[model samples]
Target: MSVTLEKVDLSLKYTAYYKQVKEELFEGSSDILNAQRSKAFQSFVMQGIPTRKNENYKYTNLHPSFSPEFSFAHSKTEKEADLQEIFRCDVPQLNTTLAFVYNGWFSRKSSAIDQLPKGVILDSLESISKQQPELLSRYASLADPEEDPMVAMNTAFAKDGFFVYVPKGVVLENAIQIINLMEGSSDMFTTQRNYIYVEEGAKLQLLLCDHSENQNNYLSNSVTEVFVGSNAELEFYMLQNQHNKATNIHSVFVEQQRDSRVTTHTASLHGGLIRNNLKFILDGENCEANMYGMSFLDKKQHVDNFTQVIHAKPHCVSNQLYKNVLDEQSTGAFAGRIHVVRDAQKTNAFQRNNNLLLTDEATMQTKPQLIIDADDVKCSHGATVGQIDEEALFYLRARGLDEGKARLIMMNAFAHEVIQEIKLEPLRERIDELVDKRLKGELARCHDCSYGKDC
Candidate 1:
């Protein structure tokens, strides 16, 4: 039987919320856009919220973290100076930046687009919808909410967000960093939608960072849709660091054309509860995609990384590698799914998930699945969950290295596989720093737990 949203209560809530927001925000918009949003919202309302029973969300529960109601208000405060301060504190050396300040207002001052080449359009979605309505209408139509409820929520309450368009044959030299910042007093529900279109033979890099400061009971539901044309190449990265009291749901949808290449990397450092949905549809021949993710959870933090790669054409290739480090009472979930459609001959796809448990109380669930409808396709998936290697540790100690230092070295080596895949120097350095800090702290914790000796 086909799964539908009518069987869930959260689906009802999503439907109700979509209706209210549709009337308030999207009523007078273009009829075509409204119809698309309506269909997506209806799909969300019918499917309801994902739960453990859902194969895609078997390891992560969405009910408890998403129960709070979010308001649909463009609440911009007078403290622009204060909010600006928070943005600069994160990555001061970042040259090309795009800031999306929701629950306050979008700002152009904080963004650096002076060096962007001609034929490349980088602006807010709100402005694009007004100035270039046709492009917005065409690209916005690509989002499908029935397949993803969080995406539907973002569309129904779509506010301000960054938009990028690369004209045919254009190659961007520098990376574009899109940062979403949310801060407020009342219970805030901020929804931002972004659309990126890379024309034929165009190449670009996009970095997305989600963050908030001192916001209690805040919800950030974001959706980003990308279109990669023939022979185009695009690299996308996401970094999420939010307050412990906040909740985040981030969704990314990409459609790749013939001979296109796409790469995505996601790093989750801290959050109260976080869920990421990364999906890609290889709709053309000879398309390639690579997805990598790493998450570090500590102190009761929860994180879920869900990825799906669909091979709809022949001669397509996809590779996914995800790693998680759990400490204290934290929990981590990794679910990677690969679907090969019929007639998608000679497809090559591989997915792997590895987890490292730093504490006895830390928990993790990993499920990697492959659904093959084509007989000629080669696809495989594997998952492993284990603690530190005791034999390896003893060997390192026997080599005259202190136990604590030995453990840190092994931990870094364990995570180096995914870290080495990062092509950008700035991002790689930042990730190295975060990983080093976590490893040091974990080593200290282990020393304290042990009786004056490293384990």
Candidate 2:
């Protein structure tokens, strides 16, 4: 299953493929999306694939993941089964406004969203561009294609993604859930570019679930851009559970205005190779941002999470926490950076990363950074990578528990700090149940076709 592309193949092969599919890529696309394809392709050509030589990607090697030749997903495939009936969140007491994305294209079922609020827009990016182009005017404004090749590649190849816009002074009590499903009969690649906008004094909660079916080899590059206006609040959460043959590059950029607040949580349960890039720019006074992430890995999985927060204005606060648990020969990494501009006074930033290695071969690397140019800012960061506490395990064993149970209890306790921070009660409980099952060597039920409790 391991494939390698030589240096020439890695560079020229992708370049040639892009040219071969030039017409398909631009067919039925919005002017906003097609206008930047040329420049974005040029940037991708210059940057190429990232490797360990890059300081930010020093731990994870992505070249081999790209070696596999895959057919790109230009449009939605024929639906064999109803996605809603085949897949459901199955969380008790969890009510949500649900939507589905088949491969990289938003499903037609989702386009007919019902029971919506007034002045709220949630629809396909391509449809919105054609119907109301002004809604997506802020697309790609926060993400920089020139800096990261993955972003550039998505910018160049992505035709459409989901879009959401909330009018000023409106608050939606129900949470919006978007399930992104990747299923195919052969190896394939997908790209999705989502844009979200919340006007002043509006509130919204969004949840994204990523799942794969049929065990096909899938590689997806998804980018999301969010803007929180003055006096607005937004809560975002992502759950990733897929087969081991999947690779994902998830990027998110958030920009907050004055007196706005944003909180995001990400849980990585299973995947072959996962890379998460999250950045926040606090562009106004009295803005706050909080981010939390956790990963559970086994087998030959590899996960890397990189984050950055820029405090560009005074009186802004930011906090970040990420934890990982690795078993077997799995490996993971975390790199978090916080930056305070020279003129941003009275800023407070904090970051922490912790990891637990369950086996001798398991590996973890953590780096926490803080760059403070303001004289009156307060900043701090810390990281730790080690095994679980033997004393705690022994104590649990002495209380008539077996070794495996004792270890599981300790690991669960360590991860509870981040899980308890989730604001959704049903989601928090479901994740707890899923984590317990994952620790017990059983995957969760969203994509497990058996429909049995054990996968």
Candidate 3:
């Protein structure tokens, strides 16, 4: 027999939690930042947890999964192990700079940066605030919390995350890597806020990973803001592989300027309940933006991908492609919106979502929306949900391949299109390996799990 959880008043719980946190944790923070936090908290109290009535959250519900009793702050008494041995890149040949965020705080002691150039700045957000207050003042809390409740919660509680800045006309020779490892010794609720800025004529490649060291039930809320100036380029890749008991909500907002190029790739390999919100605003002429995502979910896991691209200037282009593969009783959702303003006459936008159901009980919901106010725009959107083609599977089986092998080949081909968009070779190969393992149902736990012996 299973026990059902009774829903608690999340708003009231957060109100009490926020009051204690403000008085205990934020007493000595800068006045400007504290004011921003206060306004964001108020917005959160007014909006509350987004319900099914909210169109953006119509298919996903949080009340059933949220735990009001979890502690909101990290415990100082919790001891940490050797981070280097616990969290390392899967790619052996990848030579990149490294940074670590331990339990929602940027860990300077565990992070490594080799020969960072003159104009590039990579440090903790809290440290950067003390050293370069002007930079934080310019971009912190720039996103409107009233629009999204999760963003509001992150803003109100976010104290430390990553701060990255690339000055004009500088291209880093090596890629930057960020490893966010959650050391959950108890049931924990954590929030992290990140900021990134790329000036004109610059280029950057970033790889981010989310992993866990234990199987504790936890909730992680994260937000990132990125700005790309004129003639700049940014390639971003996000890989999520956490314990099955963890719940994650990640939001990314990007603003692009004239003649800039940005491509973002997200691979949700594993999670219990994962929601990813990605938005790109083409705010200048002749800019280009590309978004790609792939999710492999099985068992009782659920993954939601929400994306929006707004063409606010003329002669801008945007493209999006997302795919999901569900097995057993898993669930998935995709809601993508593209908007073109009236003055943006020469806009080109396209969106696509595809799903493959491997079991009768697996479910998928897809919605692609286009709102165009410009007369001279080319926009199209489509969604498809289907199973494996029997004929193709039969053809492969007839060629000396087993049934499972044939299905794996077909599914790998189906997802390779999105994987090909990743520019970094080492990271791409590593993701390919992981995705293959995921499809074979061999990846039951994270590589760095501390309790693997229990299995």
Best by lDDT: 2
Mark the regions of model 1 whose C-alpha exceeds 4 Å error after superposition: 1-23, 27-33, 73-79, 82-86, 89-94, 103-105, 399-401, 442-455
**What lDDT score is found at residue 237 in candidate 3?**
90
lDDT of 2 by residue, 304-356 (tens): 99999999999999989899999999999999989999999999998989999
lDDT of 2: 0.86
RMSD of 3: 2.7
- List the pairs of residues colliding in candidate 2: none
The reply for model 3, stretches above 4 Å from the true place, is 1-8, 74-82, 139-142, 444-455
lDDT of 3 at 171: 92
User: How would you encode candidate 3's per-residue C-alpha lDDT over 258-280 as one tens digit per residue?
Assistant: 99999999999988889999998
For all candidates, what are the clash counts? Answer: 3, 0, 0
Q: What is the C-alpha lDDT of each candidate?
A: 0.75, 0.86, 0.83
User: Candidate 1 on 279-362: residue-level lDDT in tens?
Assistant: 899999999999999887888888999888999999999999999988889999888889999999999999999999989999
Structure candidate 1, residue pairs in collision:
5-46, 5-47, 11-48
lDDT of 2 at 410: 89
Give me the displacement of residue 243 in model 1, in angstroms: 2.4
